[model samples]
Target chain A: MKSVEDINEKIREGSVCVVTAEEMKEIVKELGAEKAAEEVDVVTTGTFGAMCSTGVFLNFGHSDPPIRMQRVWLNDVEAYTGIAAVDAYLGATQQSEKAEDYGGAHVIEELLKGEEVELKAISKGTDCYPAKEVRTVITLEDLNFAEMVNPRNAYQRYNAATNSSDRLLRTYMGTLLPNFGNVTFAGCGEISPLNNDPEFRTIGIGTKILLCGGKGYIVGHGTQHCPGYATLMVKGSLKSMDPEFLRAAYMPGYGVTMFVGIGIPIPVLDSKMAEKLAVRDEEIKTKILDFGVQRRDRPVVREVTYAELKSGRIEINGEEVRVSPLSSVYMARKIMEELKRRIERGEFLLTFPVERLTPGKALKPMKTAIKLVKSVMSEAIVISPETSVEIAAKIMIEKGVNHLPVVENGKLVGIVTSWDVAKAVAMGKTGKVGEIMTKRVIVTYPEEAVELAAKKMEENDISALPVVDKSMRVLGIVTSEDLSKLLAR
Target chain B: MFLRLRFDSKAVRKPVISAVTLKTSALINIIKAEVGPRRGELIVEVDDSIAEKVEKAFEELGVEVLRLKEKVERNERCVHCGACISICPVEAIVLQDGRVEFLDKCVLCGNCVKVCPVKALKLPTT
Candidate 1:
């Protein structure tokens, strides 16, 4: 058996022959693991997917007066500045408080493009750091260190999601079309790194890898890592993380997601390792669940092989469903090819794991609690019907709210939204709230399910619904934002 | 005269050129043909004298004649992720200068539409 030292010597001499996980399978099948192990020096594994827990640590070299940033924002997107002076952690999923569309991922992308991003920070003046606030533009070059440390990434395999109910479900799986119109799954199937390795083997801590476009190393096993299933779960840290190697992605209807760069180097230590590297798409399997169910114990409708998923279609409960990958298989293949090119040019080398991951418990689902409408129904702001459209608009603008429920004499009358105001202004028919308000208002009861409220909003193409009591007294309001926040939680 | 034809399951696989040639041989000359998996558009130059006859012939063969337009529509689903920028061969789809701009250089090749992960970009068919 070739040892790690032998692999290193081969890499140094440029005598190592490498194949992708996909190609190694054929080679192993043709030549057998024993023969393939002797011939192949390294097997490269790759996966490209949205890792939400990813974030970057940036050290903006001490400012002129050097303020220890207490509050930091990049492009209006907040960054955690609690770490150190002028250092902040920007998470992928953190959305801008001012602009809902902008997120930390967008900030990362702007930095990657070499574009100047507006950096704003506020801090209480200290004797050592006199400045209280700083607003300026900075590029990646301005940072002393910009490193990405993802707590969890590169899931070995993931479950596919579909909707069994009649309403469309907005989920991390991309919008699950109603009535199983589509199935959304993530991962590169056969080309996935963990699917190839199946075990830690040479993929533990300290293993050199391709992170984004730069060289990185496996730091440790990712959080929520479960290893009993034949897949390797690991997180990698970049050496000199460059913007070119990373991508910031935004999912429509969903929030921001980070496209993590991951490449694993497998040393052919023995026949068993070689065999594991040769696993194919048909060999990898994952469970498919109906995300429509609100409870944590959502049933697994069926088990599907990656081969079936990659084919773009699958059958669940005797119904034909179209399948699309939320993660880009095309990008995954591109990463594998790029990694191969690096290895062939002798630009990348294999490194042994300094530490191995221990077995971890499986992740438990969050239990369904009280209905959201009831929970959030207590403190909703209400406006009077006699309140002028202009006044209603003012209240909405001042409160940064989209919907204003019109209540008269402690009873719900109608509702007015920012869109209604804009439309009324455009139509030159602005006056009292009663004149322009939607009288046939859609209302939800506090006792109903949050999913039902969301479905009503989606069905009526409205953003907010007033939660009312049996006597029609306005209790609270549930908006699309609230539903999205609940789902995110 | 250009025709934007949407083929049904029955007519998708049928030979269009052969059938049209046999029916209206010298009346129509196809200048550009863009065919996707389920639909096709043909920019054809019909002899002005027999244009009416050619239209009638295509209608008989169940080929739809549609009006052509030059605008590419970006639906509300566009999150402006800029995934389509790199794949545009003509640099028509660009997000470099802080905003997504669909330049006049677009050839309506639909490459951006295909690459868009959110299915946001739509090219005018007719």
Candidate 2:
């Protein structure tokens, strides 16, 4: 068994033989694990995915008067400034409160492109800090320090999701094409770090890793990490993993996710680690679930190996379903190749983890109680069905409400939403509210659970629901926006 | 006479095949062709006597004739993801030393444009 010290000595001498997890699999097959273990010094693992938990910590350097930033925004996307005076954490998924699509990821991309990003901050003037507000543009060169630290990333493997219902579902899995038309899976497949290690042998706390294009380390086991299953355990025991057996994926409509560049260097300690790296895609299995079900307990339709999923087809419930990976294999391979180059050139080195992760830790599902929604839902604004469509639209715009319950004679008769008004305007059908408002409205009771209400919204494909009582009196209104706000909190 | 023609998505599918068939009929020589998924550009040589006839033939085939001096264009949509940098066989696109530079070494191979996941690279169409 080779020791970490031995590997470091070889690296220092520039005589250490290294191969990607992909290449090592072939080498191990040709030469048994015992032979391969002695020959290969290091095995590199790579995965690229849109890791939303990622963010950059930036120290903008002190201003002339040194304003302690209370509120910070980069290109309108808010950055957490609760840290120190000028330091802030910009999360990848944090979007501009003003702009629709621009987010922290875009700001980073723009910075990498060598373009200036607008930095706006508001500070409460103090004795030491004088500036009330600062608006300026800064590029990567302007920052004193910029480092990306992600809490959870490089998941070992992921479950594939598909829609079983008749309607289309827009989720983080991308659009699950209606009726299981497509299965979307996001993972690095065989080359994945945890997939190669299986039991987290050589990777832990401080294991050096490739983050983006820079060198980083594994901080901890990622969030939602569920281990302990013999899921990817290979049979007949030849130990060596081929990164090629891993598949790269790309999720449509979800932006590029699981495409975040990640590489982990594995120190070949013995034949056991070599055997783990040799695991192939065919041997790695994942559960496929029906995300169409609104409940947290979504049913697992089938269990398929990564090989079958990567082949672009899997049988789900006896029907053929086309599968597509949301992560890019090309990018993953490129990351692996780049990491290998860095190591061979003596620019990168592997580090031991400061702490190892405990296996079999299950992530508990978050339960959203209905009481949270009731506290957030404001009083419902009622409108007369006789109100003109133009006036109803005006009320919705002025009041900043998307849904307006049309009540007559003290009973909720119909509902008019912003979408209905927009559609009316688009179709040139401006008239009375009664003519355009939806008479058959889907609703929920104040006593109903938030999950049930959210499920109803999903089933009907509506954004807003009028909360009513047993007497059919409008109590309040809950919207998709409110649920989002609840979740955001 | 020399000309450069840009083809749309439909024409890019069977670019050479369609161009060769049209070349036989129009009596124009296809000097070279570079094709990609969304678009492609071609260099053609035609006798000055039949230049107008060849141009008409390409136009009928729904190909846009670009100015001969026009080069590949990068649009505002470019996220500068650097996907094109490594794939460029000519080292035309580069991301080095904190800069993303497009060099003149570009052979217009169109490989960078195809590899761009963002669809930001645009060939000289106008």
Candidate 3:
């Protein structure tokens, strides 16, 4: 029984590594793009976050003061966080498996090592829905894990010729989503149906424990259970209301949050956990309300004696079992299948302590919240505004450059469009160069991430930003006109 | 299945009419799954007034009478689970010694088969 810390350390020490977009490109460059594409197989789309924010919850207990605590709440946390990450990692890894020399288990082993993967966000949200983005970097490290657990890869050699329409990677991605999501729903069940991504395995049938002996049983869909729900959240403004009135009427806990990996299923832990959590929650809340905020002492795992374990009857395979240290999104699926088998056989008697399971032991680092912002432009070409009217004409004539940025003192000061240059010449101002320059500059600092750049562009009603450094020196430029091109294969 | 009744002729004012239909062997197999096999004779006894009503309704429906019978004995037994008693549009079933006795007023529509708990009640095959 390794602790979470211990297990993480071990994984960190493993030889597997993830690959980034540049590394993948290098592989493609070495082995022709067509050949490189042939070696890898895609698994599935990774998980994604919908709403990733948290709010403070106040728990009223029997203690001295009402406990004001920070409770993480979201509609579907596990699917969005750890599971999503694994999904992304696995999907990318599967694509990497197509590498000619790398095949099957070997690829999976490599992915576990970790790779530098660049996930660029494609889009953001509208008023009705949360943000949505498509990440498009498949690395060698991701390929390793994908090939390892993939059922098809597990059964057949990478080079082995097989006839099956289900061999396509896109189909594989579809299969993984439902099954993984189902585990998040049903607690546990068989994965073979999902692994095969059978046409009929459309619904998630929960564990059916027969009180009688026969296989004749009822099937329950875990999706039917609503994990946690709240009244619609109000986000706009509450400043006008009186403080006491606001406090009484409002439950501050009603905010949208992105759920991390799957949470621990409510049933697996020791009985005292809920009680302990309840007590700790109350203590933390009291301390917070008393002095505005207080930190809780980290909890220690309580050891159970052999006698206590036997008496408690929390056993798996006839031996006492405790909460698993950390389960990957894939591992979580395996556990669910085991649970379903035990339940159907009437072997599972102990209750699950929690309703959710997290893929990793700890929450994802907050920095992961910063996803790569995508550019809107598909094509771009750089041109200088200072070029002579005739030179600009010649460049535009030959290269089809649509926009040109004006540079002064190594800083982008303005932009002159080909359209502008043509118009300036028609209006008798082209050759002067300075007269045609548009001085209203839209620029983004290199230190600022893609998301912030996008926001600033949106606010200013601009299409492109000249990338600048700390000293306002121009590095490169991004424009809506050329963004799509920059991101294209 | 059969029905045997001992009744005064005057009690059945109009000519007492009885009808029956033949069913397939598959029907029997289905019934057997739900209910036990037939045993003693099935007996039906009906009052004259209800018997006249059943005859009129069946006649108006343009259904041909299978067989007009005064009495017939067949090996069939019904554990009066009250299925037939509750199902009959008319009060036609009388229970005695855990057996069901239907009156002549039975329309013989085979509805009891549809409602039988164990499918103990069924239409007889020719």
TM-score top scorer: 1
TM-score of each: 0.67, 0.63, 0.23
Best by DockQ: 1
Candidate 2's TM-score: 0.63
Candidate 2 lDDT over A1-489, as tens digits, reads 888778877777888888888899999899988888999989888776556666678889989777999999988988999999899988767767875445777676666556789999999888898998999999887887777666677767778888887666666665665787778777768887788887777777667777666656666766566673312111110011122222122222344222356777888899988888899999988898998666576889888898897675678778866665655565677777877887787777777767777785566778755353466566898899999989988888888999999998888999998898999989999888998999998877775668778888998999988888767799899989888877798
The TM-score obtained for chain B by all candidates, in the order given, is 0.45, 0.45, 0.38
Candidate 2 docking DockQ: 0.05
Indicate the worst ten consecutive residues by lDDT in candidate 1 chain B.
B90-99
Q: Classify candidate 3 by CAPRI docking class.
A: incorrect
Least accurate 10 contiguous residues by lDDT in model 2 chain B = B78-87
lDDT of 1 at B47: 58
* Model 3 per-residue lDDT tens digits across residues A365-470: 3354332222332233444555677676676678766566677666666776677778977888757455677887776655445665666678887767777665
Native contact fraction per model? 0.00, 0.00, 0.00
Q: Is candidate 2 or candidate 3 better by TM-score?
A: 2
Give per-residue CA lDDT, model 1, range A1-489, as digits (tens): 988888777767888788887788899999999999999988877777777878888888888798999999998899998888988999889988886556998788778667899999999989998999999999887888878777777787888888887776666666676787777777777777767666677778777788876777667777778753433333333335555446666555577777776777788899998888878778888999988776566779899988898665688778767666656555566677788777777788677888866656686867656575887554567887677778887888888898888888888888888999999989987788888888888888887778778878888989889889889998888888878777688
What stretches of model 1 exceed 4 Å from their correct place?
A228-245, A365-489, B1-126
Q: Model 1 chain A, poorest ten-residue lDDT window?
A: A230-239
- As for TM-score, the candidate ahead, 1 or 2, is 1
Ranking by TM-score: 1, 2, 3
Which model is ahead, 1 or 2, in terms of lDDT? 1
DockQ of model 3 vs. true complex: 0.00
